[model samples]
Target chain A: GAGVSQSPRYKVAKRGQDVALRCDPISGHVSLFWYQQALGQGPEFLTYFQNEAQLDKSGLPSDRFFAERPEGSVSTLKIQRTQQEDSAVYLCASSPGGGTGDTQYFGPGTRLTVL
Target chain B: QQPVQSPQAVILREGEDAVINCSSSKALYSVHWYRQKHGEAPVFLMILLKGGEQKGHEKISASFNEKKQQSSLYLTASQLSYSGTYFCGTETDYKLSFGAGTTVTVRA
Candidate 1:
């Protein structure tokens, strides 16, 4: 079976440009999450979704970040007025269940570079 | 908050042993361990639930200490395939907070 996958494996944007990253979770996955990983650092949580509900966005760094998982499948993370600080690897993960101990399978990630 | 991982980094030869520790400030319901190589997504290694249960994968094993709010990953007879950055994600509710990560390098 295909694993979770992210589109535009690499994206370069101007500091003020807006960018949208896409994620395709594994088939039948019910839980989805987004994270940001800076160079040489751990991945920081961004947001989470269960089906079509955006359950946790507390990890989102700012109002400029927005995410949607419409129809309970594919998800997108949009950044408005991107900043140099927003440059990092955007990772998406999904688990079969929304339970506490379910293991998350990750995508290759989309590396965004702000010039 | 993000958990704290010890020893930041380690280097070992094949067939050696290494331990990576993760400590959290708050109570945890579960702990997940993952390994990521350069330019790749993290691969799930194992998960330990609240009961302080221990799980193993091949030569890798992990233990969760609920009372101490900590987890330790044990890599026995390490192989070159084990070289990567290991992250521990601690979950209190449904959301998981991951540690900074511990980088391990295995040489022949």
Candidate 2:
């Protein structure tokens, strides 16, 4: 079975540009999450979705960041006005269940560099 | 809040042992451990639910102390394959707040 995957493995954007990162979760996964990893740091939670519902966005840093899982499968994280601080690897993960203990399968991630 | 990982980094030779610790300020429902090599996504290692359960995989094991809001990962007879950044994700509700990470380097 294919694991979770993200598109545009690497993206370089100019500051102030808007970028959209895509995630394809493992088939039939019900829980999805997005995270950001800065260089030499651990992954920081960004947002999460259970099926089609955006249950938690508290981790999102600002209003410019938006995410959606319209059909309860695929998801996207969009950043408006990309900033130098936004440069990092964007990771997407999914689990079969919504339980906190469920092991999450992570995608390779999309590295975004703002110049 | 993000959990704090101890020792920041460690270096070991084959057949040595190492321990990585994670501590949080708030009570936790569960703690998840993951390892990430350079240029790769984090790989799930194990999950420790509340109640101080201990779990093991191969030579790697973990213990969760619910009362202290802390968890530790122990690697015995370490191998070069174990070299990577270890992260502990503390779950409060449904979200996981991860620690800064502990980097482990193993040499022959």
Q: What is the TM-score of each candidate against the true structure?
A: 0.99, 0.98
TM-score of model 1's chain A: 0.99
* Model 2, span A1-115: residue lDDT tens: 9999999899999999999999999999999999999999999999999999999998899999999999999999999999999999999999999877888889999999999
Pairs that collide in candidate 2 are none
Judge the docking of candidate 2 as incorrect, acceptable, medium or high: medium
lDDT of 1 at A114: 97
Q: Identify the leading candidate in terms of DockQ.
A: 1
lDDT of 1 by residue, B1-108 (tens): 999999799999999999999999999999999999999999999999999899999999999999999999999999999999999999877777889999999999
Residue B106 local lDDT, model 1: 100
Model 1 over residues A1-115: C-alpha lDDT tens digits?
9999999899999999999999999999999999999998888889999999999999899999999999999999999999999999999999999878888999999999999
User: Which number leads on lDDT?
Assistant: 2
